[model samples]
Target: MSAKVMPDAKGRQVWIAAISKKSGYSEELVASVLEKHGIRPKVTAAVPQRLMVTSLSFTGKKLGATPPSDIDFGPKPMGPGLWAVTSQRNFRGKTSILNIIRWCLTGRQYIADVMTSWFTAVTLRFTLDDREFEVRLSNASEGTGELLKHARGNEFQLASFSNHVEFEAAMSDFFMEELGLQKIENHIEKDGKGIDQPHGWVWLFTAMWVEPRPSALFGVQMPGAMSARMMQMYLGFPWVNTTNEIKAAQSRFRVKAAQSHLVSSGIRATTEGRIASLAAQRADLQAKFADVSPNTARLKLAEASQRFVNADADLRAFVAKKQVAEDDFESAKMAYAEARRSSQAAKESAAAGYVFRAIRPVCCPSCDEVITEEAAESHLRDHTCVVCKTPDRKGDDEEDTERTLLLAENEAKEQLDAQTTRVRLITSQINEARLARAKASEQCATAEAEIADMTTVEENTVRIQILDAQIAELRNLNQAETEAEDGDSKVLAAAEVITKEMYEVEQGRVLKRVSDLTKEYAVTFGIENLQSVSIDGGVRMKLIKNGQPTFFSKCTDGEKARLKVAATLAMLKVSEDEGVGRHPGLLLIDSPGDNAMVSVDYENLVSGISTLSEELKTVQIILSAVSGPVILSHVPKARRIEAVGDDYLW
Candidate 1:
């Protein structure tokens, strides 16, 4: 309604719409997706009323004593306006009482360890709006308690718990429901990254307690944006919780982005390194390939190899022919010898026959008579053998047989001569084939030696092919890595921009109001030569004194005390006046006059608190300090809860 949507459904819708525009997604899809991720705005609605303590009571017992002794502290009555708890000295239980009240209210231990060990039970009674509530603890250390509400002479049980954590959570829930205080969330460091941490009543009570050491401009001194968030929560600024949630999400995104970037960069670097190595190998292979003159080498080797193969084949043929020729020569020699023998035998036979015919001798006849010559001659004329022929018919037959033997021998001699000539020719051809094969072998060897550095062109070509494949794969991987980007960072940035735009003007106005109040209250607390005070949304307070600039930490202890008080009172006053803040209207100041403070400064602080308490009737100011004339004059005797020398405040 006020131009800036309060932290609610509308706020969430606004955030979703803004993110959708940046991310190019539909609003409904964006909302569902973000919801799945647990990314939604926090709601901040201001409560107009405040909580006040009406009474406090507790019991303590001496630990480990021979006889147990119990000491009782009031059912002390406390109401609105300035109430002082004082002692002449330190550690006199003045601060203890305040700590007990805080412990009972938040269910957290703020008292000294000794008190926590000694105290057995505590009870705190407080009021919210027109309703009264009571907290009863059976064991203070364990925080075993029951929360009760009183209405029309009847008591009602609200919650009960048995341990500290449960007690704290119950109390926080009760207060959030009763007082409209929402849970606060902060980003804390875990394992070198920011994580979301939800806080309950313990964190919300930062504005309710003021420590002795003045550190920041507003609410319990904390680190980073926590203090600012505390201030904003108390001041009832619109969208404060949403802003804090967005900032925490941003912190988580930053840590994740950094980690994702490192991982992506490592992948890219490894891929690039592989690509470089493969490229170098490819270049080296290319250079060697060029030097080898592959085309010429391949041609020369092919030619020489073919020539060698052909020549070797021819040599094999020639050797086979020579073997055949040798076999034929041996056969021819044998044939020639047989032919000569045949011729000799035929001639001898012819000569013997002619001699027998010319002599005409007869060895035996039927009667061995002396007329053989005349008979043998007659038989020869008849062509018959002399020894056993009935008639003379052997002459023509013997001549014909001798003539056939002579003719066959002559033919055999001619065939042997031809075979010998053929053998000689084949032997010469074999010699020539051997010479040609040797020449071819020499040429092939020379060609092989020329391209020895390349280890045969085939292996070189394979290496080149492998190098190319690797380079291509690496390049593709590099491209994929480049394309895979972090989308969370962009979403976080968009969220940050949208949240900032939503709350800047409203937060500026709130800070200006607080700064003005701080300057005014600083003067009221008697800060010397103070011209102006400026407080930014960062909770950084700058003081302009005598035309010189300074900050909260730079001031002296006394001045810092004054500044802290001023800031606290300014916030309270602003909340009361605006009717829009969530401060509980309860201020607990512990040792505001410590650290060798100036007496006048202390008096001025007491006097100012008295006047402010009168002006803001709803605020209850509880001051713990050493009893002095200044405290005596300002705080009435009836409201002073004091401990004398060497005594506790109980």
Candidate 2:
């Protein structure tokens, strides 16, 4: 890779800043990708203030069949030093005292159930950076408590809670704010799925205590990168916290990408398979059609289809022509009838005029007398009325009227004849059109029947066409789905790898320092023949014991306990020296000698604790053990909370 692509000093920058610097992506786009994958960068906590226990007290009533039916611990005053809560034997309430104090501080009860059943109330007072505060649990079993602060001579309530959940939240918030601690966010695989689990002040306080059980590494027995996160947090490397956040974000992004890819692959595979099936079906239908029909048969079918279409068009034209001819025939008939009626009326009028002219008066209308022959002959010659002796006035008008009527009748007769001829011609044309339409209709029906004989093969052809369209659509969908990841997934995957590499590189320096100090402290705690100790970036400790490589979990119980104590002290000392770590300068150990086979080894552990406590003046060390000369010789009487013989320390 070129230097431009692989930028130097990548570990010091935020994930987005580092990847986007030379990766040709904008910070906004990178941030959007991170958000899409639910990868949020974490903020490192500020340098913490030292925590010291000044005094603590509690009251308990033992359960049935238990020793010490009732017990009360004092308002014990203490300061920063090695304090021992011990007895001549085990189960002496030494661990109980530590548990009470831890419960008060964190609101999480890790005490044994039988022992917790005996507790009714607890009171603990502590300080952060010399700021005095107190926790008073009036109802310990119910987890109700009040956190109070002291100023001048008065006590002010900081928070009040009524239940365990609220109590834990209150204590966590108070301590986190006062001690300058932030939640340690990480990604873990639970039940085969990656999820976010954040550790608060309670988890951070794990550094202050060590139980009798053997621990593989620092903090609780969390799986994956959590113990490493705890180490980075308490060790307080300058930029290692940012690395931790990047690791978590990268893990989340990978899981998200993997899930998305799986789903997309499944969908694409299904779509492609469907498309292939559709294409094959289409091809099979096409091949069957080609195989079943000869070219001559195909040509015959095509010709029949064309003739059917043409005949159907011709039939429609003939029907329209027949309708026009019928309408013409009816119009001609109507014209002929009107002309005949007019001619008849003209004939009747002409006849009436002629009769009226010919029938002149034979006698006087008033007297009914006959006209004389000479008068009648003279009237006829003169064309006059005989009775009135009036000269004939109806001469030219009567002739003219008769001539006009005759002429009108002749013209009307001609018009009637013409109309009758037109009606005959139109009727003939209508018959001809009807015969042509009938012929075309028969031809269309025959052609249609021929075409219908191939219906099965034509149906297959139509289905094949539909399948082609569907296959094309499916192919488009598959292409779109497959291309979706190239935009975001590609960029995010690159960024994830780069961020992980950055974390690995950045953790090296801090881990080396922790490793060196661990080896030194291990030798001081009497780890025999310790050649070298290596703490990797993942916080996996490797030690060369007796010239053989030994991991933390592979070590003996006694050796693991000593190694854990050594690792804690080493981290505390490193934090103190660095002046930037988050440890609260407190250490608590339970039953340090329980696994010790030799008194010398137990003495060495106690001696190491004493030496470190004296040298680190501001640090507090509290441990519980079975009473022995090894513990009594190093820790003074003033710092010892011991049992009377085999009695309980409570």
Candidate 3:
């Protein structure tokens, strides 16, 4: 083993300020303990990757037309721009239009049974960066659909499939192909059991799009942890692989430790119960040790002699300890004498000041002037001294103060005397103990000599030996289990270190990018004091206004809407800036006006979307909103689809 331990390159348990302070453990001690148990984390550098979606469109056979009417998204390729599908009227199929596009990109449609019942042979055409592919799903309402795929220049290639499984797989493959997503395995723990499966498109879809909900604070519609994992994947970090591995290892260790605890508990119970039952067995063994018989088979002569000598040595050691204790007692006696002297001095000092005030001078000490008893009485309460006629103020001292001092002195003297007596008694006892210990030593020596002569042990003696061995084995087993428990504890500690370090070095980058970009976007959207946006585990979007995080619930409706838009857009902007975001810059925003936001803020939100579309050359936004002048004015008439008269989006 190397005297100097090196931190693993991938990851290692390093000194954590928070943990060390909370635990009251020194860095060196924590490190030493962790090293002793071989609990070191291995660090691996994450490689960057990026993917994005350019465009998405879909069309199906319409009623009353033998040939299908076209909803042309590709009259021209609108580069990095906004496309709006707006209708002020409720249930006019505006959401349905977005949902249909969503269903093609993802596999979920609005009321899948209902939508498929209404239309069949629906074809989805979308551009992924440069490649244009179309997938058509037919035979819905029967819980079955046929999926066909083709490029703009190529024929519909994949063979038609009528089952939901094949159709779903085809859709998943299409999105995965466009997003450059991998079907990596993820270990999931359910009911204390761990299982692994390839990450599905449902998880990825949460990152690609967000729908408006009256009560929801998060933009994504997935669980907090899942959303966070998806964001990481989109940011070019491999979350499914590393996080899943950590989770799996953690769960495995937890289950193993639990099992170990159960087994160890059983063993402990058995051992304790056995100890009670084996008392008679041990008593029999002790009797054999005391017995002297010709048929008794003795232990090896050399070992027996050594053990006997050790017994005598123990007695000798007791005698030596008693001698040391006796010497300590003598020193204590000397201290007692010194303490008595100190008490006497204290008593003298206690009365000296009082004596001066009590006893008056017949003559003045300063000037050799004789003072009569009448003069002394006058001096007790005089304004001036009689001898010198000098002004002075003196008062009579309290009576019986000397008596109080005397009583204290007496009490102190009694305590000192008692302590001295105790020391004397202890010394006498020590002498008796020394004599007793010497006699024991002599007896032990004689026994040792006799035992050395023995060459055989009795069967009863063998039973005693066997019992002793069994007891020792049980103790060893317990000790081993204790060490194993410690090892498990260290492993958990080290795993925490790995997670902390990974976030510090890797996740911090993504977070920082988001913070900076969200601030920039917030500024563009005219949100002042908004310094940044923070998505913690994708659970909540906190706006960092003037350096303090402002929660979503705390902000105004308009501010909330802007913050949400800023976060979603900023993530893509940051991804583009780093050239490593998996997001293809295609945004599908549902109901930007749902919050009934402030007029200026709502307009700003629309204008900000339009400006971003122009600034970010790689992004394409498909926005759905209610008919409002703020939205209609910002989006050009040609680019915007209005649901006035009979021209509904559906």
Candidate 4:
């Protein structure tokens, strides 16, 4: 049969062969393993002839471009060699399987040559030194029949080539070298010869095909001669080479197994008890359902029979009781209808009587005139003649006349009693006024006595001392002038005298100033006269103006504003005396005329403010005005804050 190998130059298929050994794996198992390794093979034979084949060219198409697929070229006829392609790419390169086989074999070809033999089936051979082993992978092919006969092949059976090869290699390496089983033996000895003996020997083998089929069974042949003796030594006369300790271990294992079986039995019994209890509870529930109600289980036939019995009994009872009640109800309704008609007729007769009597008006007894009942009652109770002041005696039958006479007598007595009360009130007031006058006289006498004890000597003494000093200074200047020789000296003396007189004159002018201030304060505070200024009472000057006594009563709005400004200045003067506006400075008035209308004598008020500002030279005036036409027309440089809304001073 034609086979397909790797892709050709144009990427087309070429003839190739695919061979796969069973290795105790099913066709599906082999297919799965091949697929996992990126090789998809189709199963061509099963049972006696187990093999899988997948063309290299077909696999190449599946893998896409890149590394080319490797094709098998069959083993060498007489030497150890593997057939494989070296050219693993699509482009020009060397293409041969011998090259790949030579790479793997290396110096091991001498051992591998003895293992290369053609057979009908895929038989993989492995040699360890001189020991040769063969594994029949699958049934032989028709073309391989002659070769199989020479090789002494038998009928196909389940076999594992991977297991036989791995086991042979493991045994050879372990016995001949320390890389395998010998290493394990050395480890056991190194632990100590007397250490607990190993219960069993375990061998692990690694073969090329073993990994893909992990679940497949691996048959290991421990040389028959050796295994046979081992079995005899283990079972027959087992105590000959085994220690007593080993026997004890075997006994202990048996006893533990027995105890485990007993525990399992106990668990099973407990489970059975729980099951029995559950079954009993279920039965009780079923019995309870039966006793719940007999009708609960009734069929439709039984329900219909019960319904028919109930309907017949109810119909008969309804007919027997209904007739008697209907007859009695009819007779009672007729009597009620007749009684109701008679009652309605009597009500109509009473209403007719009321309507006829209401048409006429009643007359008033006192006035002897027609009036409504409501008005008549009012007139009778009041007993007054509305036309004149006379008592209305018409309604006074004996009882009412007597009542009226009694009322008249009572009113006369009330008037007499009121006159007596007035007399008593007048007498009481006269007595109270006399007593108040006597108390006032006593208070006046005490006040006059206290006033007589007062004196002004201490105040006059202080004023005399100030006047004496001024007189002595003038005398000294006059004496100095008298010493001069000529009339020019007299003129200079006259000039000095004039200057001294002016100073005295100014001091005297303050009296006029005080008088004017007192008059203004008296009018503004509505007092009779100025009294002494008291230094002890916050610089308060008492006044009695117009028979009204007041203290520091110059409290008009303008005065109050001036007082507030003065107080502010006094506070500032105490803390700092030498700023921009120091003593002996001129007063500047700007907007003083604007608020002049509010002052009593606007011009005099402005003049007084300017004088005070000059006296307290640190002070200044800034006035603003809105109108220039009327009062305060003389004040110049009066700046006005422009008016905005109605009457607003912004």
Candidate 5:
């Protein structure tokens, strides 16, 4: 790209300066010199245009005065009156050019020299790289030169080129009459070309022009570079300074972003996984607790604990209130139970006592009278006479009745005594008869037993005598036959028959004695009347009755008494026979004596009893009588129990 220079209406000289280290000045150093001279400069590197002066600096040297070696210095107005003095003085060859351009752009003497110089009437072209670009100077006069020389003689420096330049007549006339610099539009261009297309190149510069003094130019004054540096510091870029605040902010931002991303993603995944896994775990826990729920268990345990606490509180309250004593409830219950049992037992015992009292008969002690249980109880309560303690006349008959009962009791006792006496008498007689029968039976039995073993030869003495008679007859026949050997055999036989007859007669007499003894045994002992007698292997005999016997079987209750008397009598007889007898000897007959002859055959029984007592000679008869005829006829000495009434026997 290339740039072209243009003249302003003020006839101000403008140029381009390639600022580098080789030119012994930087763009920043060039712009600083222009700023110090009160020249506002525009700066550009790739393109040229108006720019603000952000900063400036200078090298402490002067420019050379030789041709071809002179540094390029010019006015480059970036704004209405702001200009930059740019130079391309080769600092490598002549570093002093840096100070020379510094003085020309900013020195007060150089401002006067340009205003008076002959070339001041025309513009100057001060291109550093191209010769084709130039300016024409005009309208210089000797008077202007003398004024400029006088202005330079003073030590006081002008604050700006406009101080002198504004005095130059020609430049002032051109600015006012021909060029009208103040009216010229400030248009930006590129490549020394008009901005007719999007890609035109225009040489951009700034001018600070005044009459009779040199005009100043600045090339591309850049305000953006400084702003960029300020922004770098303000924004705190990490590349410039690691400790920059922006770095801390960036570090904090990155860390927060990473943490947020991790948290968000992790929370999302966890929520999803938890939803599914918790469902499965819930099912598994339910199955595991199928038999029992943990919640239920906890609830039950809590309930139980609560109940226990409640019970403990209740018990404590009860004890405090003295409603219950420690360990006393059990004892109280036991005592209650025992009391109940004892009460029941006492009731039973009382019931049994009532039963016993009902059955038991008691005689009143005061009256000697029997009373029923109820009457006895009343009598005991009243403590009155049991017979007739009442003074009421109604009891007179009761007194008579009691007297009659007393008489009856005395009569009953007398009867009992007489009956006892009679029983003893009958018992003695029966015992004598039983003993006689037993003796005769025993003797018969022995004889029968002895006869049972006898042989016919021992028993038939007649037969033995008959045999001896036969044998004797034969012998007699033989003796007779020997004496009359032939005289008559018949007569000898007759003599043997007579001898046998005499022997048979003697055996018949001995057999008759055995028949008489057997008949005597049967008649005396009554064995002939016995139906049967069973003899045991031990020789004990029992006599059986005949088909029509006189005695009764299994006696009546009344008869048992009589039979008991008979049995007692038999026992007495046996005792007497053994010489160990204790017979009372007094016979007392009671009620049976009145009807003793109901069977006439019973007379034989009575006689037999009397005969036995008489034969023993130790027995006495005492008979009690209610009727005189009965006992008086049987017993000569019979006693009657007397009553207190009119009846003698009563």
Candidate 6:
């Protein structure tokens, strides 16, 4: 714990932070531990890094340059806030402008969908930490294959790509250096699967930029719980995400487990029942061997063998008959009991009905309805109970009542009579069953006695030897199963516990920290009732407001827009404070005002974002929005752009 194993984020940091917040430990303790590990980051200068899309130029010719191109979108060098690429509703290539910036920086397929027409090349320039940078990529599908380069200052010198790989490397390296991003393994759950996928430092865009569709949530996949691993790494815990040791252990364990499976399958093919039967046969064979004289070739006389075969056949027939008798007796007993129970139930029901009809009450038993004397007097002709007005099965007339009671009694008596007949028949069958069982048993005993007395001439020495061999083979199989299967089982059990413990530690470090960070940003985004943010259990970006899960898909469009902004910005703020993130303070938010919010809420959200740029000076946010009533007002004259007549972004 003293030696910082990982600098940025660790179980120790979480524990210390927890203790520091409670038991009042000084931050020096945390700083000391952090110094022992991680990149041991140097102090960031007061001046912060900033990214802006300075200019975008497109030529109308393919590959090798031809016609002079027009400047599609260019924003004034507004140092921070946002390099807003606002456009009228027809998309006006506003997204295309943002995407082109994404393409140049990350080499992603920025404009592939919209780049249907010819464009000789697209050049882009931006400044990071006051140092200007440029990327002039050839829209050519051929030649160097990729247009990528790096240059600082006012000069736009050419640094062409040696190949696509080198181009990518250069881009990654430049950003890592500029944005303070470091190389580390980040565990991402691709496609919302629970397993963690470790991607290299280059795959960091999943967090650095915001996807246009905010509902999808976390890091290129559904709120990946492990995505916090990357967020933590960028937040200055670069060393925390490097898990080379566990990976090595996992690799070794897999090989051992596979071999264990092979041995286990072999053991499964043999059954305990077969082994027990073999043991019994082996004992019989041994006894036969003991009786056989080594000098004698055959033990059975031909005449005795014929007699023995006849006795065996008679014994088998007698045993079969005994089994049949026993089965029949059990079936008859069960049937008789069931009939008797049914008859008793019918009798009880008839008795209850008679009691209910014979009695008269002043008030209804149910619902407490009153039975006035006047109502009862009128009830005699209606054949209904005066209290509740339920029609009687028999009229209230003395004769009808008597007849109904008698009918119930007769029905009960008939059921009893039918059951009594069945019971008597079953009793007689039971007696017959016992007699048959006894007779069959006596005959079986006589046949068995005859079979035992009969002698045999057949030799059993070969069979005895075979039984011994089988028993030996089974013993070997049992031994193999014990050795391989048991060992494999133990190893897997231990591995599971170890992996779970490790995951728990990771959960403590990432889950809580991400939530805390996410909540802070959510508050900054004007989310008044933001409760907490959780990225645990593989449920990524779970927003709980007022202690309940806020479903992403179900939220009003406006909420989604605001929340998406909050969650993404939360990460940037985390990286800023933690000083361990590779976020590069770059946010590519397509639009912030497109959700189901009222115009006022949208204005507040836009205003909040505009204010945020000044608060977190190091971060870069590029927004693309349809030129709406609210958008034009907040966006600076220099940053906002409206598409004319037929102008589309693409």
CA-lDDT, candidates in order: 0.76, 0.72, 0.59, 0.31, 0.31, 0.55
Off by over 4 Å in 1: 1-15, 18-33, 42-44, 63-69, 176-195, 265-486
- Candidate number of the best TM-score: 1
**Every candidate's CA RMSD:** 28.0, 21.2, 28.9, 71.6, 96.3, 30.7
> Mind giving the per-residue lDDT tens digits that candidate 6 earns over 588-632?
777666555566776777777777777777766777777776666
TM-score of 1: 0.64
**lDDT per residue as tens, model 1, 109-208:** 8877755678778889998767899999998778888999999999999999999898888888887776656565666557756676776678778677
Count of clashes in candidate 5: 63
* Cα RMSD for predicted model 5: 96.3
TM-score, structure 5 vs. true: 0.15
Candidate 4 per-residue lDDT over residues 1-650, each given as its tens digit = 01122223211110011111213333344334333323221111111110111111100111222563332223322111111111112221111121112111111121123222322233333233223333333322111111111123453322222333343343344322221111111112222232223222222121111111121111122321222222212111111112122222333333443454465566556655655665565555555454333332223334444444444444444444334434444544454455445555555655665564333336544777766565545545665433332344433264454455555555555555554555455455545544554554455555445433331333234444564565556556544543322222222233223322322342233323333444443233222243422211012334454456554335443333332223223322321231211111111122322332354444444444444434443333333233323223333222111223242210
**Candidate 6 stretches greater than 4 Å from native:** 1-53, 61-78, 114-117, 127-132, 143-203, 215-217, 222-226, 244-528, 531-557, 595-597, 641-646
Q: Of models 2 and 4, which has the larger lDDT? A: 2
| TM-score per model over all chains | 0.64, 0.64, 0.54, 0.14, 0.15, 0.49
lDDT accuracy of residue 475 in candidate 1? 65
lDDT string for model 3 (289-381, tens) is 555565322333344455546655655665666566556656666665665566566557656745555556677888777788787777667
What lDDT score goes with residue 337 in model 5?
55
Query: Compared to the true structure, candidate 4 yields what TM-score?
Result: 0.14
Residue 431 local lDDT, model 1: 80
Which 10 consecutive residues of model 5 have the lowest summed lDDT?
197-206
Q: After superposition, how far is residue 500 of candidate 6 from its true place, in Å?
A: 12
